[model samples]
Target: MSGGEAYVFAAYLALFVAVLGWLVIHAFKIARLSRELAELVELARRRDGKAPAPDAAEARVAGQ
Candidate 1:
């Protein structure tokens, strides 16, 4: 293969790796935020002195 072709292939590979790394980082951030949101919801429920209700998804299933 020509040098130019090799360079092009390497550049594409690098771009693919960079995109994959970004997706992984974003996924972790989403997971962490979800956990924080759940915690806040629980705290709010406690402050209101209300019993915990089923999660929305769970309630939907139970309703069906």
Candidate 2:
């Protein structure tokens, strides 16, 4: 390949890597958020002195 073509390829590769990195970061964020949400749900159940209820939890999450 010509030098100019090589540079163009490198630029596209760099862009792809950057986008991949961003997706990975967001994936981690989503995981963290889910964990935090579950913790909060459990805390609420304890404070109310109720046993864990799956349907109620699903409805709460859906309402939000």
Of the candidates shown, which would achieve the greatest lDDT relative to the real structure? Answer: 2
Model 2 lDDT-worst window of ten: 54-63
lDDT of 2: 0.83
Q: Write the per-residue lDDT of candidate 2 for residues 1-64, one digit (tens) a residue.
A: 9999999999999999999999999989877876678778877898899997766765666566
In order, the Cα lDDT scores of the candidates are 0.75, 0.83
Q: Clashing residue pairs, candidate 1? A: none
In candidate 2, list every pair of residues with a backbone clash: none
Candidate 1, residue 3: how far the Cα is off, in Å: 5.4
> In model 2, where do residues sit more than 4 Å from their true spots?
53-64
After TM-score superposition, the amount by which residue 59's alpha carbon in candidate 2 deviates from its true location, in angstroms, is 9.9
Worst 10 residues of 1 by lDDT: 54-63
Model 1 per-residue lDDT tens digits across residues 4-53: 99999999999999999999999898777666666666677778998765
